[model samples]
Target: MATSSDSMLAISVFPSLTGAESVSDEELAKQSVINYVEAVQTGNIYESVKWVVDTRFSSTDEQLEQYKESLSSNPFSDVSIKSIVPASNDTFTASVELTRKDDGETNKVSYQVIKRTIVGRY
Candidate 1:
């Protein structure tokens, strides 16, 4: 069994804006949030979670399995971003709901404030 700390080390946040101190535009923040959510819904289980999740959330592929297990154990297989708010120029927060196709029960899981370095927008 992996310790909590070990499990936490699995995810590695790639180089991307975290929406904290780096982004403030509601539209952009919201869009990014949308993109992140979309990526997960459309992406493979392993690759999808990496897009919006940080390393501290989980470690190792097995740990990620646990995450999947949690969702699978429930009824939701996909997560949808219901809303987003700009916490600050460097912080963007989103309220997301996880729903399962089988049960149709949506559970809310807050991903805290997503922050990131500023990436130029077209």
Candidate 2:
């Protein structure tokens, strides 16, 4: 059975449902950011790239390929998605905290405002 997180991720990424079931753009954008963070946490570059609207992390095919290869040994240990706030109709600001696996250090955080396309088509 899929968990609530999984369900939310699906709803956020794929907004289409039965007729008359619609997801707001803000909700979609918020979910997309969450999905992106989850992808990064799992070290799945392909998944992460799926949610990116522009060349924030990579701009070229070669760079994307390199990112795919780098997922094998992810630098971060854990990721905590703090908040997803809507910036505009199709944009959201996500706050995330990343923890290094090597040391027991914490307190590191980042805020990323992502603009998601209708279907994230590049």
Candidate 3:
């Protein structure tokens, strides 16, 4: 009773149902670091904050304001991920090279990225 189009739709939906093609923890951690760095480089505070779960910022609004202020004071022209190494089961250490917009000086910094699932309210 299924057409070719129906078969194709079922094929695509099968992976989502089975959860067989899920991304690994290491890969997810690496991607989080990359996304965070990209967001910071582009001055996207909203996106940047989404990748971070720091206790210093009391609220989302506070984090946004702080990130915005920090970015304005010390902005980077470019950020490149040099390496990402697994530190633990769900944690990764990423080495990144950043070029300062003010003086164009390149500096290497390492960031600890922890992958946590965000619970969605439906």
lDDT tens string, model 2, 1-122?
Answer: 11112211222454444232376656555566677768777777767756654334336575467666655543667767677776555455565566656664544443444443354231
Ranking by lDDT: 3, 2, 1
Tally clashing residue pairs in candidate 2. 0
Give per-candidate clash totals: 19, 0, 0
Candidate 2: deviation at residue 113, Å? 4.6
Provide the overall lDDT of each model, using Cα atoms, as 2-decimal numbers.
0.49, 0.53, 0.63
Would you estimate the TM-scores of all the predictions? 0.52, 0.59, 0.73
Model 1: lowest-lDDT 10 consecutive positions: 1-10
lDDT score at residue 60, model 1, on the 0-100 scale? 58
Residue pair clashes in candidate 2 = none
Best by lDDT: 3
lDDT per residue for candidate 3 within 1-122, as digits (tens), equals 11111000000112233363485655655666776777778888887776677567678898789889989997988877788787776566777788888888787776666655444200
Tell me the lDDT of candidate 2: 0.53
Window of ten residues with lowest summed lDDT in model 3: 2-11
Q: Model 1, range 1-122, lDDT digits (tens) per residue? A: 11111111112132243444454355555665555556455544565454444554446576467656654664447666666665556555566777666767666655444444322321
